[model samples]
Structure formats: C-alpha cells, structure tokens
Target: MLQSFMNVFTTLGDTVVVPIVIFIVALCLRVKARTALMSGLLVGVGLTGFGWIINAFTPVVTKIVRQMVSTTGINLPVVDTGWQTSALVSFHSTVGITFFIVGLILEIVLFLIGYTKVFFATNLWMNWGFMIWGTLAYFVTKNFWLSLGLSIFMMLYVLLTAEVQADRYSSYYKINNGTVGAAHNMENVVPAIILDPLWNLLHFDRVHLTPDALKEKLGILGEPTFIGGVLGIIIGILGNIRRLGTLDAWGQILGFGVKLAAVMTIFPLVAHLFGQAFKPLTDEITERYSKGDTKGLSEEENIKSKKRWFLAVDDGLGYGEPATIISGTILIPIVILLAFILPGNKTLPVVDLVSIPFMVESIIAVTHGNILKTIANAIVWFSLGLYMCSYIAPIYTHAVAQYGVALPAGAVLIASFNVMCRPLNGLIFLAWISGNPLWIGLTIIVYAAFQVFLRTRRQQIWMYLKKMSDRNIAPTSNSNMASEIKKQMIKS
Candidate 1:
C-alpha cells in the first residue's frame, strides 16, 4: 500500500505536486492567495520547461553517444543502465519505504527546532537521494536500522555542507535563494576544493574559460547564445564525423547543432520562470526578517535576526548557465575515454554519460563554471569513480535480482555512474558495515566536526561569501583569507 501510494505520488511528479506544496507553504507563511497561486503556477510551468529542455537534449545527446560507442567498440563488465532505473529500484526497496515516510517526519522535526530551515517542498522527491545510499548500505549489512540511521545522517551531513555552498551557488547562477539538495553529495568536492589553488597558481584562471570570462577576450562571440551554437556545431560534427561520406550526414550534423543551440538559448529564459516561482517567498522572508526594529540590539543580535534561510532546491535551475551546459556535455566523452583508458576500470560509460552535467552540477557550483578547472576536477573524479562503480557492480546486480528486476539481455552486471561514485557516502557506508569501533567512531567525529562548523559559523560563512561577492569575485572554496577569517570567526 505504501508503494502504491508512492507510485501515485511520483507519477504526479514535481510539476503537479510542487505548485500545490508551494501554495500550501506560502499560505502557512501568510502569503497572499494571489501571490501564492502565481508562485505555485510559475514553479509548475518552470519545471515543465526544464523537463521539456532535458527531454529535447537527451535523446540527441544519447544518439550521438551511441554512435561514438559503436565506433569505439569497448565493452566492460557493468553496463550503465542510467539513473532513472536505479532511482526506481531504490524507490521500491525497503530503504526507500523507510526514508520517504520516516525522513519526512524527521525533516519536519528538524525545521521546527530550528536545526534546519530548508522548505522540504523546494527539494521535493530529492529526499529519495537518501534512499540510494541507504539501499546500498542495506545490501552490505542486511540491517534496516543501520541503513536508515546512515541515510538520515547523510541527509544531515549533506544539508550542512550544502548550506555553506548554497548561497554561492544561488548567487552564481542567479537562482532564487536555494541550495543544491541533490543525491550525488559533495564528497568529491573536497579534493577539488583542496586542489583549486593550483589552477590559480598556474595562472590558468586568467584564461577564464567560462562564458562570462570569455566575453572579456572575444566580446559578442563569447555570448552564451553564440557559444552554445558553436559548441553544438562542434559536438555535432565530432559525433557524426565518421559519417562524413554518408548521404545525409551533413544534414544530421547541422540539425543537431541547431537544436542544441536552440535549447541552450532557451534555458536562461526558462530559468527566469523558475526563479520567479520562489522570488515571492524570498521577498517575504527577507522583509519579515528585517522587521521588528533594530533599535538597541547588539550587532550580533541584529545579524542573527536578519539571517536568511536558503531552501534546498533542484539541480535544474543551475543548468541555465552556458558553462554548466558546456562542461557537463563535454564530460560525456571524457567519461567514455576514461572508461577505456583508466586502469582496472570495469564499468562501461554509457547512458549515464548523458547525465554527466547533472552529475557534475555540484562541481560547477563550487568551481563556479570555470571550464578548465571544472573539467580537470571532473576528470579526476571520473577516473576514481569508474573503479568505485565497478566495485559496487555485484551488489547492485544482486539488489536488482533480489527485487525480481531483470537485467538487460546479454548484460552480465550493472552499475550507475550517478549511484556508486559517491566517495564520502561510500566511505561512511563501508565504515558502518565494517563494524570496527574505530572506523565508526572516526566517522562520527567527521560528521560532528562538520556539523559544528556549519551550524556554528553560518553567519561568518555568509558574511565572508557576501564580502567576496561584493568584491566581484566568485567565492573561493577555501582561500587563505577565508581560512583566517574562519579561524577568527570560531574564536568570536
């Protein structure tokens, strides 16, 4: 019965459900009915636009990838059946059942206590991200409690980490006040953040490969619309290169390019609709917080009262930027090459390659869409991720079989790029299943430390990032200045 209800719930999907949820939440916040209605409708329409955009691009991109794969003729032990199938499998699992029901309850409790401030509706259905790791943990431990506990911890962990980066993401993409609450957590981002300075050290940041950066060098040619068209044409030509002598090859190439260009051009417009959906809430929240006169309050007291809550939101809103589109699309082929060349990799890069953009959205958030750094960071990630996915293949296959799901004919095993490459989640799950007191204790310490930093330093973090924004620079992940300020912030 739970699964039946879930199925119906999912079928209604974000477009239908988000608006209603948003309306209800807006009403609860005392939003005018007309404004609430507009917010909800805008959200629904915006999401529908995102769906259309994704649907339009995916098939063409997949077709291009299929050609590339056929040409390469590389085979591997695990087939990438894509994320939707994996999400479906997880949603049907015991872990999914517990997370959807229990997770919702936990979120409400956390919000009421001021432990968290995200409106659950903004990230609707994303809570299923908790189930992916939970299901994987269940595969190793056979204990539902362990799975549920870890899943809950991961949710809290991701939220805390996401809170730090959320404002930067929103500011960079011009999305309304929301943080990424997607499933592919930010584990890999730690290394990327650690290594980011090298690019600056090498003066590669001067090239500023992001579209915004390019405008400095090339003017109108660097505009996102133009860059999108050029990228589309390049991809079209490369994807169909082998068919050069074929009758309709040129037609196919130009058609794909034009379509891609159109999609890219349309994204920011759709994103505007998306932003409009939540702007009313953001405005209200900002106004409410600024009220109740700051007459005699201390600086700290005033700052605390004026603090803003960033809702957890979808990755789709981040897709509008040209850098995000370019870097993610480009990663598909990079993942393919890494699959073929990376030593000991047993997972074939296939369907999920198309999802490389969404997969790397978090990276884009941190890297601020700097193409060179983003691509370099992602290459390292995929290099390690391929092997990790390969390692998880057997358990994934068993989970599918155990659930009476059939594999594709002639497929030996399966892994999803989006599923198994979560480095931190994988570490935590391994520690739990290892049953070593030391490992479990260390994991606890890690979460506790991050929790302390995130919860305690929210204001400092916000102020620091805001200052960076005021300086007209993308927020550095962890600069020397930032580290020093944080040190002082903790003491204060």
Candidate 2:
C-alpha cells in the first residue's frame, strides 16, 4: 500500500509523514512547552537517524557477516543476504517489532485507566503471567546480546517509566501499594518466559531457574516478594506520572523513547552474546533427565526436571507450537488429499479455512494479556463470525465437489466445527488466564461440547488422559474440576 503511495507522490513523502505526525502529537499532548519541543525533536531525529543508518549500514553488516561466515567455513541460516534483507530485518527487529510488542503491552495499561486496583487486581496478575511467559520465550530465542542491551535499556526504562506511570496513576488518586505489590501469576507467565533466556544470560544466570521452574516457583513474576514489590512500585510510579499534570506527559513520553532506543540498541548485542546459550542450557537440562531425575528428586535434579517441563510446554505451546502440530498432523494431509483427489483446480482447502482459528488461538495464547489480548481476541471472533455467521455449507460442499475427494459434507462440517470451536476455546482460556467470569462462560460452552463428544465416542478423551505419564495429579485434577463444573451446568 505504501509502495503505491510512494509512486503517486513521486517523492519520499510517506517517510516524511510519520515523524511529523509523531512530533505533532507529542507537542500537542505535552503539558510543558519545553519538554514538548525536546520530545518532538528527539522523535524526529531518532526515527530519521534510525531509518538512514539502517539503510546505509545494513548492507555493510550483512556483507561482513556473510564474508565472515564464508571465511570460517560456516553456514548461517540467513534469508537471502542483501541490503534489503538486512534493512528489513533490522527495521523489523528493532523498530517495527519493538513498537508493536510494546504497544500491545501498553494497551493493557489502558485497561487500568479509569478502574480501581481491586477491580483489575486479578486481571493484572493474568496480564503479568502472560507477559512474563511471552517475554521469556522471546528472549530465549532472541539474541542474548540484544537482550543484554534490552535489559540495560529496560532496567532504565522500567525505572523511568515506573516513575512516570506512578505519577500518572497518582494524579487520578491511584495509590501506590508500596514496593511490594502483586505476586507473579499465569497471565504474565508467557512474557516472563519469553524474556527468561535473555535475562538469565544477561545477568549471568542470576535468575537461574528455567522458565517453567520460574513459573512454578514464582507463578506470576518469577521473582522474590521483594522483586514483585519493586516491580509494582515501578509500574505504579509509571502509572502515576499521568497525575503530574499534562506538562509532564512529554517528559514521560521522552523517557519512554529513551528506554525504547536503549532496547533497540541493546537487543542485537544481547542476541549476539547468547546465541549459543540455548545449546548449553539444552545439554545441561537433558543430562539431568538422562540421570533419571524424577519428581521429588534432589534440588538441582528437581530444578532441572521443572525446567524441562517449563521449557517443553512453553516452547511447544508458545509461538503457536500446538497449532503447528495440529496443522501438520491434521490439516496438511487433508489439503494434500483434496489436491490430489478433487477434480477441478483445487478450491480453497477446507482444512485451510478451519485451521485459521487454531492458529489464531495459538498466537493469542502466547501474547501477554492486556488490551492487546482483548483486541486480538475480538479480531479472532470477527473472523469466526464471518465464517459461521452464514450458512457457508455450500461453500464447503462446492469446494469438496470440485475436488474428487470422497470426504463427506458431514466430515467437512465436522472439520469446520473443530476449527470454529477452537476460537471459543480461546475465549475460555482468556477467562481462565484473566481469572474472570469470561473464562467461566467459555468453560461452560467447552464442557457442554465435550460432553456431547463423549456421549458419541464415550471414552476417547478419558482414555487419552489415562495414557499419559509423569502427570501432576493435583493441578490436573483442579483443571478437570473446573471443566466438570462448567460441564454439569451446560451439558450437551
């Protein structure tokens, strides 16, 4: 779309607009004149400089990397090596990705905007758990050097933003619950996990606990009571900055920018540093398993065992891993079958249509809960609404007929049912993660459906559960209890 505009403008006009808009927004919203101007200037300079430096330097970096690889007889899984690739990766990783990620996270704060602490207290933990897990996973795969840079940048950012947020929230009569605040929970677990590898490596293993261990040890923040208190204070402070009147908005925003820049600069460095840490972590972790460290093992062994579970679940379910598995196992073969058996030019794969929701849930499940989760979930519903809102049975039937496939319309419908229901499952998950009524409603729907399925097959799900090994009965039972309570009320 922008490409078309570039041709129409016959100049670099598109590039010209963002900075100008950013500056103007900063200037207008800023309470203080001096801070506004400075913020405006910084935004303009920083963004422009970033674009230019990336354009000029990316090629050099790529060439140097490529040459280094060739000389050392190394082969890196680089997507086509060119200036464009380098620039794209740089822009995406540093600016685009960071802004989007932070923006998504920031949206959660908006949920707190006119609400009291008591109302959002539970929601906050859910949000934290999701962020922690997502951030930890991101860091694990992300460059350690990049994370180091991000950590230093984030530490400062957290501190500064904490002050600003505290001040902002305070303006609205929000009280800081001192340094000690909420404990880490499942909501932010994903972010914590995403940030874990990078943070662990950056701090020289200060948070030695694996992402899973951390989650189990520190369900929400994965830190001590002191750390949670400190974090809450920081967030409280950042939230409070809005209380300082409009004049401070510019400074607060500027501070945030500095923090973001620090992240941009440092993440690449962190990525470079911990590029190989994943290997050693894997090795040490695997060695423990081979040593037969089961539950109730020695501390190190138990720790390793816990780490393994966290790593497995986080990685497997994180990053749409579950959906990928499902698609590979179920969708792909369906698509292939249709392609080969169907008569006419292959119509859209039925599996393709159905797979969309599974993928959506996978992504949403991993994203830190906040306004982002709400917005993303809304989008998912919109998509499902489009598909199921109408009797699109003909669409499915026609597609199937066009192909010579023998799959019945009923089978296609079932497949569609599976996919459509998947998104609703996401809603239950959302409620569960949020620890709210939303989860309860969705759980009812899921349990009802499960009961219907059980009546037909009678024993598949139970049989499947029974076949599993190395289980955590208490937690599993609790989850099942939640499901059963939901089931009894709305049995299908």
Candidate 3:
C-alpha cells in the first residue's frame, strides 16, 4: 500500500504537486487565499516554462555530446541513467517514502534548538536526493537503520549549509527569502570551503564576467543576449567543426546558436515570474514576524525574526541567471573531453551533462555569479564525480536493476553524476560501506565538525562570500527591487 501511494506521488512530478504544496504553505502562513491561489498557479507555470526551455535544448545538447564522443572514438562502460533513474530507484525503496518525514522532523528539531535557521519543509521532493545515497547504502548493507541514518545525515548537512549560505543567496541572487536547498546545490559548500581560498589567493575573484558586470564595461555588447549568442556560436562550432564547409551544417550551427540565444533571453523573464510567485507569502511572513521597523513583534515573532529563518526552495530560482547558464553550458563539451582523458573515469556523463545548469546554481550564487570561478569549481567537481559514479556504477546498477528498468541496448551498468552529488557525499558513502570503524568514525567527526563550523561561523562565512561577491551594484534586474535588496543586505 505504501509502495502504491509512493508510485502515484512520484508520478505526479514536481510541477503538478509543488504548487499545491506552495498554496497550502501560503495559507498556513496567513497569506490571502486569492493571492495564495495565484501564487501557486504562477509557480506551476514557471516550473512548466523552465521545463519547456530545458526540454527544448536537452535532446540537442545530448546528441552533441554523444556525437562528440562517437567521433572521438571514446568508450566508457557505465551508462549515464540520469537523475530520473536515480530518483525512481530511490523512491521505490522503504527508505525513500519516509525520508521526507524524517528530514522534516529533523529540520524542525534543529530549528527549534537553534542549530539551523533553514525551514526546508517546502519543496520536499528535492529531498529525494538524500535517498540516492540512502538507496546505495541499503544495497550494500541491507541494513535499514544504517541506510536511514545516512539519509538523515545528508539532510542535516544541507540544512546547516543552507542556513549559513542564506544571506549570500539572498544578497547575490536577490531571491529575498529563498535559499538554495537542493542537495546537489548545497553540497557545493564542500568544495567552496576547500578551494575558495585558492581562488582568492590567485586573485580570480577580481575578474567579473557576470552579465551585469559585462554590461557596465562594454555597454549593449556585453548584454546577456549577446553573450548567449556568442556562447551558442562556440558550441555550434564545437559540434559542427568537421562539417563547417557544408551549407546545411552552417544552417544547423546558426539555428542551434539562435535557439540558445532565445533561451538566454527568455529564461530570466520566466524566473522573475517564478520569484513573484513567492512574494505574497514571503512579504506576509516578513511583515508579521520581522523584529525590524515593519512591525512590533511579539516574543514569538521576535524569536522567529531573530532566528533569520530562510525558505529552502528550489535552485531553479537562480538556474536562469546568465552566469549560471554560461558556466554550466560551457562545461558540456569539456565534460565529454574530460571523460575521455581523465584517468579512471568510466562514466560518459550523457543525460546529466545537459542538466549541469541545475547543479551549479548554488556555486554560482555564492560566487555572486563569478563565471570563471563557477566553471573552475564545476570542472573540478565534475571530474571527481566521474570517478565516483564509475566506482559506484556496479552497486547503483544492482540497486536499480531490481526494478527491471528498460536498459538502453547493450548497457550493463549505469550511474549518474548527480548520484555522486558531491565529493563529500561520495566520501561519506565510501566510508560507511568500507566496514572500517576508523573510516566511519573519521567521517562522522569531519561531518560533525563541518556542521559546527556552519552553525558557529555563519557570520564569518557571510563576510567571505560578501568579499567574493560584487557590491554597490544591482543584484536583480529591477532597479527599485535591487535598491531594497541592497539596503537589506547592508543592514544585515
């Protein structure tokens, strides 16, 4: 009965279900019923529109990656089953159906104890990411408690990171109450901690290739539209270089370029509509609870405001930003090339390659849209994941194969870069299944220490992000909204 219900829930997908949840949350927050209803519909529309833009280009990009691989005569053993396979395998398990409940309880408990300021009960579907590791851990040990513990730990890790990074996301992406809560996105805090100092020491933080920065220096030529078109042309050339002399090839190239250009132009407008969807609920929460001049808060309201709670929403909110798009798209071909050249990497990174934009939003947001740093961070992360996905492909294959999923012809094993999620997650899983008490203890200690750092050093983390991010400039496209954001960011 639980499995049957789970199937129906997963089948409904995000666009259909998330908006309904949003509406209910809005009403619970005491927002107007009419406004809540409209907000819900707008969110659904925005998600659908994002789906349309992504779906339109995905097949094309996937084909290009496959073609590039074929032309280069590269062979990788593990098939890239993408996140659909990963999520389905995850949700099919005993661990999956209950992870949402566990994660929510944990989130609420942490918030109540003042250990985390992130309220992530919204967008619970994203919690499926935890079960990827949970599913894999279960397959290895067949131990339910251990599997559940891994999932809970992954959730706890992200909740803490999300709280620490909330100020940066709001200040940089101008999403107000929204902070990236996607496990794939928040897990990036791992790399940022390890390598961010290197980026600073090398002075990579000084160069800004974000769209707004470009516009300031080069005028209209630096506009996102122009940048998108140029990036499209580069991708076109990469995909069609061998056929450059043919007329049809030029047509395909230019047409592909124009398609990307269209996505670049249309995505922000779509994103703005999505952000507007949350305005009513966010405004109500802020006005009702904020201890600031907006309202004289009761004790409860003051505690709520002082906690500085942020909504852990989808990364899709910032996925449309120019730097986010560019950083992910540019890595498409590089992913293929690296797959061939990187030692011990057996996964070809097919379907997930097209979904790179979703994976990089948090990194881009934290860097304040520093395209160079974002790409640099992504390349390192993806390279490591290639090895991780390859190492775990057999177990992942075994985990999902029980479902009797239709395999692409001649495929034996499969994995997803996203299932690797991040190096820290991969390391945690490795230690758990290693059967080494020392490794397990070390992993626990490291994770516990990191969580403590996020909890205690949040202000220091925010200061570092502020130093890395641009200031005294518009964070959002709307000048008035940007001014308000600037004021809030300053006061904070």
Candidate 4:
C-alpha cells in the first residue's frame, strides 16, 4: 500500500503536488474557492515553467563541464554529478517512500507547534535531503529504524534553522506576505550560517557593490547579460582552446555567451510568474490572519499581531535573481581553476557548477545584493565545499553503491556540493570515521546553540536590514519600499 502511494506521488511530480497542497492549505485558511484554485494552478504553471527552463539549461552546462574536463585532462578519483544524481540515488533507495512519509509528518508536527511557520508541502520533492541522511545513517548503523530516526532528527534541525532566517529572507526578496522561506537545499544552510558572522566581522557586509554600480562604472559590459556572455566566452575559450583552433575557439566562446545570456534573460520572467501565482494567496493570508484593532498597539505588538505565516517555497526562487546567476557564471572558471590548483582537492566541480546560485543565495541575501561581498563569501564557502566534497566522497560512494549505482572508471568515489557541503554531513563523516558518538552529540549541541543565538539576535537582524536598505544606491521598487515602510512603522 505504501509503495503504491509512493508511486502515485512520484508520478504526479512537483507540478501536481505543489498545486494540490497549496490549494488545500488556501481552502483550510478560508480563502475563496475560486481564488484558491486559481492560485494553485498559477503556482503549478510557474513551477512547471521554471523546471522546464532548468531542464533546458542543465545539458548546456553539462556539455561545457564535460568539455572542460576533457580538455584539461584533469582526472580525479570521484565524479561530481551534482545534486540531481544524488536525488536519483536517494528516491530510488528502498526506504525512500518511508522516509518521505515520515518527513511529511514531521513537517506537519513542526508547523502545528509553531516551531516553523513555513509549510514543507510546497517543496515535497526536496525530501531528497532527508533521503541523503537516511541513506547515510543506514549505511552507518545497518539498522533501518535507527536510520529513519536520524533522518527525522535532521529534518527537524534544518526546518528550525530555516525558520530563524525566514523573516530576513522574506524581507530581502521583498515578497512581503506572499511567500515563506525554505532551506530547500539544506546543505547550504549550515555553511552559510557558520560563515555569516565572519562575513560581517570582515566588514564585507557593509561593502555595497551591485550590478547597477557595475553598469555605471563599466558601461554596457557591466550589464548582467553582457557580463554573463563575457564569462561564458572566457570559459568556452579556455575549455576549447586545448581541443580546437583559435577561430573555432572564438566561435565556441560566442556560442556559450549566447546560451548563458538566454538563461539570464529567461529567469526573471519565470520569477515574475511565480510572484503572480502567490499574490492571491498572500492577499488571503494577510486578510484572514492579521490581528484586528491595531491603532494603539506597540510596534512589537503590531508586528506580532500581523500574520506570521508564509507560503513556503523552494530555494530555486533565488536563482531568478540576476546577481545569483552572474555570480555563478563568474565562479565557473574560478571553480575549475581551483580544482586544478587547489592541492588535496580531488573532486572537480563540474556537475555542481550550475548549482553555485543555490549555494550563494543566502550569502547574497545577507550581503544585500553586494556582488563583491557575495563573491567573496562564495569563495570562502566553495573552498570549504571542495574539502567537504572530498571528505564525504568515499562514504557517499559506498551508500550509492549499495543501491546499485556504479562509479565511473578509475573513480573510486562520488560527491556533490549539494550533498556534502552541509555541516551535518561533515559531522556525520567525522563520526563515521572515528566510530564515535561524540561527534553526533557535538553537532546537536552546536545546532541547538546556533538556534538560540539566532532567536536572541532577531532585533539586531532587523536593524541590519534597515541599515543595508539605507545603504542601497539602487532605486527600490515601490513594492519593496512599501514593505520597508511597513516594517519601519511596526518597529516604531
């Protein structure tokens, strides 16, 4: 019966599952039936379109990566297939369905307890994060029940961390009440949180550099599309120069330039569609849940009285931003270069190159569109990421092999940024290697401490947001300005 249910869920995919869940939630919140249905359908359509764009781009990126690998003759012991491969290994495992069900129940429970305001239903497909943990735990303990238990604990850990950052995420995205934040890629959260304070300590957070600034300084070349095109051309020239003549290399460069520009061009349109889908739902949530009689309430009370809930959405929503894509594009050659030069680094970041946006999104948010800061933060993050990927490769290879996934020739291991970048994974790998339960205890304690620290720093975070907005030289959209004004009013 469970297997049948899992098959049905998998068949429906995110397009169906996300819409159905959103529709149900809207109805339960007393949203009008027509509005609910329309909102749900819009989300489905938007997500479907977004997924199509991603699918279209993946092969283009993969081809470039393969070319780079071949031309460079850089052989590593592990193949980096990125998160997509990991997702496949995860969902195909024997316990995939069971893990999904357990994760869903845990999300619901967390929501009911007010431990999380973001619903996980909208991103049910991202349960691959849970699957990664479960698979790893099973490999370690050889006990299914214990593995399931550990996976549940990890789910709770990530959701709680996400909840702490959701307010800032919503503010940064200027989504207002329209959408909630989710740590869809849990791997990015731990590193981001750990590194955020260091970014501030270095005063990089105060350095304001945006794409618009680049445009003013460099003219047309600074435009995101142009920059993307240039970066693509550089990468193309580098990758193909070894294999093709100068003329052909330039042609390859231009071709790559156009493809990347296309990707940059299409993303924002998809994001706008997603925003449109969420509007009705946002209106309904605000109207139904906002506190009544707010004239004399204190600022804190006023904010508290307003609805705290948001429609949880995927981290893919972050990719639509130009800065993210620009940063990711710039990082591709840098990452490849690092793979070749960075001693002790075994994994080339080919497959995960496209995922740089997801990894860098949180840093982008915290830095408030400072591309320089974002890039700086990304360098630190991915440096750690390279090491983490290397550390987890053997364990990941073993777990996947158990599911009949074969490693490539001369490849004794496998790893991806999306799977191994998490501090949770690092701790687990340490625990596994040392055969000590102390590492697990230490990880839990550190996570718990971080949450408490975040909860206490809420006011400071709001102040930081205010300061960042004030420093922003780019003109704010009316919606963003209004959101800022509303936040200010509440604080006052």
Q: Highest lDDT: which candidate? A: 3
Give lDDT per model, in order: 0.73, 0.30, 0.76, 0.70
Candidate 4 lDDT over 1-492, as tens digits, reads 767777787788879988898898788878999999998898888888889988888877778777887887778776787786677777776556688887887787777676666677667777777777677767766777767766666676777656545555666665654333333344454455565566667765555467766776689878777877777787777778775667766676788889888888788788777777777777666667764344355534433542465567766677867877887777777777877887898877767778777777765665567677667756776777778788778878888888777776667788776667555556654554344568667766776786676556654644554454345445546657899999999999
Question: Where in model 1 is the C-alpha error above 4 Å?
Answer: 290-306, 463-492
- After TM-score superposition, the amount by which residue 440's alpha carbon in candidate 2 deviates from its true location, in angstroms, is 18
CA shift at 238, candidate 3, in angstroms?
2.0
Tens digits of lDDT, candidate 2, 303-362: 223222211111111112222222222222233233234333212222232223223322
Report the lDDT tens digits of candidate 1 across residue range 1-492: 878868877899878877887788778777788888998898889889999988877788778776777676677878888787677767888887778778877876776577765555456677777787788778878888888888888788777667666666766676655667776745555655666667667765555577766775689887776776777677667777788888687777778778777877898789777887777776665456546354455534433543556666667776766888788777777788888898888988777776676776666666666778778878877787788788878888887677777888778998788767666766777787776779978988988887788687877865554443333243334466799999999999
In terms of TM-score, which candidate is stronger, 3 or 4?
3
Off by over 4 Å in 4: 178-207, 216-219, 243-247, 292-307, 428-437, 453-492
Q: Ranking by lDDT, best first? A: 3, 1, 4, 2
Q: Give the Å shift of residue 339 in candidate 2.
A: 34
Stretches > 4 Å off in candidate 3: 293-305, 470-492
